[model samples]
Target: MRGRTVVEFHGEIDIATTRQSDQHLDAATARSAPSVLVDLRGVTFIDSAGLGPVCRAWRRAVDRGGDLTLLCTDTRMLTILRLTGVTPAIAVTGS
Candidate 1:
């Protein structure tokens, strides 16, 4: 049953850890879950590579009439996104 996949990632996630994050996201995509909740409460860092996959996931959700909701409990990640000015582009919650 393809349903929602809630992926919670922690620790530093930058270009160095992109592949690792990608692997997780790819697994979620492969499942094609109806809804995906990416919780970034424990994330210590995130580069474009890390952000790209989420955007891609959002697109995939839209394409499939599904939804991708982002829940972030880390302020550091929010700052990075604000500075990058891509938070609005991607659905994010809890700055």
Candidate 2:
């Protein structure tokens, strides 16, 4: 919440949806010190292709002196993020 731009992702995140996801993430992280919250609780599945855009967004936010947080309670998604080393890089919160 707060002043962060919240981007909620739903369904499966795979190669088929990475392009669109990337576009959205890029736009969200385009400004200076953009605080973004990526809501992934609605996501059912996610692959490495899906994580690419998220990592990129996190980097962009950090480079701009901002930050990105991930809100996910799904065990599968959380595991994927942990296994991919994204949990340490991005702030993750669960409900």
For residues 4-94, could you state the per-residue lDDT of candidate 2 as single tens digits? 8999999999999999999999999999999999999999999999999999999999999999999999888889999999988798999
CA-lDDT, candidates in order? 0.75, 0.92
Winning model by lDDT: 2
- Candidates in order, TM-scores: namely 0.78, 0.95
Number of clashing pairs per prediction, in order: 0, 0
- In candidate 1, which residue ranges exceed 4 Å CA deviation? 1-3, 31-33
RMSD in Å for model 2: 1.7
User: What are the per-residue Cα lDDT tens digits for candidate 1 across 1-95?
Assistant: 56678888888767777777777766766644357788899887788877877777777776766777788866777888778766776778763
Spell out the clash pairs found in candidate 1: none
